[model samples]
Target: MITIIKNKTLKTLALCCALGVNFALSGCGAGDSVQAQSNPSTLATKDLSAFVNTFWYVPQAYTLAYSYSSSTNPKTTAVSDQTIWHFTSANGGYLLGCSFTSTNNGASWTSATIVGSVTANNTVSLGFFGGLVTVGSGILTSSSGQPAFLMQMSSGIASTGLTHWAYMLPITSSDPSWSSLPATNNVSVPTATASGC
Candidate 1:
């Protein structure tokens, strides 16, 4: 009788251990499932404008070869010039503008008209882990007959606010000087003469 009681007790303890192991394995699987569901790639689609608004433009100098026509003809002329960039606030609801200056043949045009308060819409798509910025459709017109549609791919870190952007413009008839300005490190406010519109 004593031997039978001991055997029953040992069997009951073994059964409880097996049950505990099963519960532990199932709990681990559930935790993995939760992690997979929380992946950033599965997040809802975000508006491009929302991403653009989060960054204010940091001024930099660029050397650009610009032309006015869509044709890559041998006759197309390229100019080296500079421009200043101004970006919108954190809602992508405003027009970010560039003030460009050009010197050609001893003649200088200062503050040449860039896009006038043109608002960018859903033009950006964020990448997984915020490693890239994909620009959708950007439409801006120059004072001359040059109309620009820009699509850019940029890479940067969100924590440092550093990014590199590349853009392509369809050919038109105006060849503008492309240059980069010295660091102004100043925020630009719209002047009254250009403000009433």
Candidate 2:
């Protein structure tokens, strides 16, 4: 009888362990990585306009990229400068493909995909915190029957009156590929409607 009880106790313990792991892995407080943003390095301290482009559409539904510079010159990723990729999904959700940290002010780019929500609206809310553009959220409304889309951000480092920015660039596919992407100067400013998200 003792042997049977021992076996049952072990089984119960194993089940509990599995449950705990599953809970941790689940998407909770997933607001643009509400958890990961706890790290001070990933916050968007730059203007975020250096990498923003007010385009009409994301051609081919390609992924987008953004980079931040803590100083006119940086030599380490820990100085709090970060790069993020905005990935569009077929499921109508957006994400960061990988993360890049630069102490060199992006002298050479590396791969890093810090997960988070990039934008949101009353109907669709997406993005994670602690992202290079964590405080930056926007609306992505595509044209009817066309890939042409309009992106508008409620919060950007530039909006907060800063020079350096966390802006966007195009990556490979609309799919989430964590390869490499470069920031762009092509980001533009467009007339936008108020964010209702």
Candidate 3:
């Protein structure tokens, strides 16, 4: 579920969502952060070997929700949309293909796309239990070449089991804040729905 809110509210929601997922999976506190390391060569053999060519995505039912409303009326309306993600390996990295299906409570549907590439070396360390993290650039296929970004992570904990999460958002070509969006929106503890190239 995706909601449209004022800019401020949206930012708050994104942060809350990210922190919520982080804490739920690994007990990360408000101050805890996902540390990124670009040199994959320096990682341990186990860490490097953990990543495999697989397909995973956010289950439609678990998508983030969004709502809209009038400030004076105190009433809000929400629309739910489902996003499906596909990942493939390329050039020692990963290629991400995403499809956004807008549905009217499962009545109607509209699909959109965002394509991205995750370089092998552009990674984040989430500890041995958390697994590998991949970050890279993306583009909204429907837009006028609007640049975007993506982050993918695999995590496992005895309490919550295993899960895979991916996040993508639009960014200005020169946006210095691009790196922060993935970390901030890395919410949702959805397990990989399927596995394949």
Which predicted model would earn the best lDDT? Answer: 3
Candidate 2 lDDT by residue in tens digits, 146-189? 33223332223642311123323333334232222222223211
All candidates: CA RMSD (Å): 19.4, 18.0, 19.9
* Candidate 1: 10-residue stretch with minimal lDDT: 28-37
Best by TM-score: 3
- TM-score of candidate 2 on Cα atoms, chains taken together: 0.26
Per-model lDDT: 0.30, 0.30, 0.32
Write candidate 1's Cα lDDT for 53-140 as tens digits.
2212212333343433334454334544322333233332333333323324213423422232234332333221112332223444
Worst 10 residues of 3 by lDDT: 188-197
Candidate 2: Cα lDDT at 11: 60
- For model 1 the local lDDT of residue 186 reads 24
TM-score of 1: 0.26
Over the stretch 17-88, how does candidate 3's per-residue lDDT look in tens digits? 565532332223343333322343643322222222332333333444444333424343333433334332
**Could you tell me the lDDT of residue 187 within candidate 1?**
18
Ranking the candidates on TM-score from highest down gives 3, 1, 2
> lDDT for model 2, on a 0 to 1 scale?
0.30
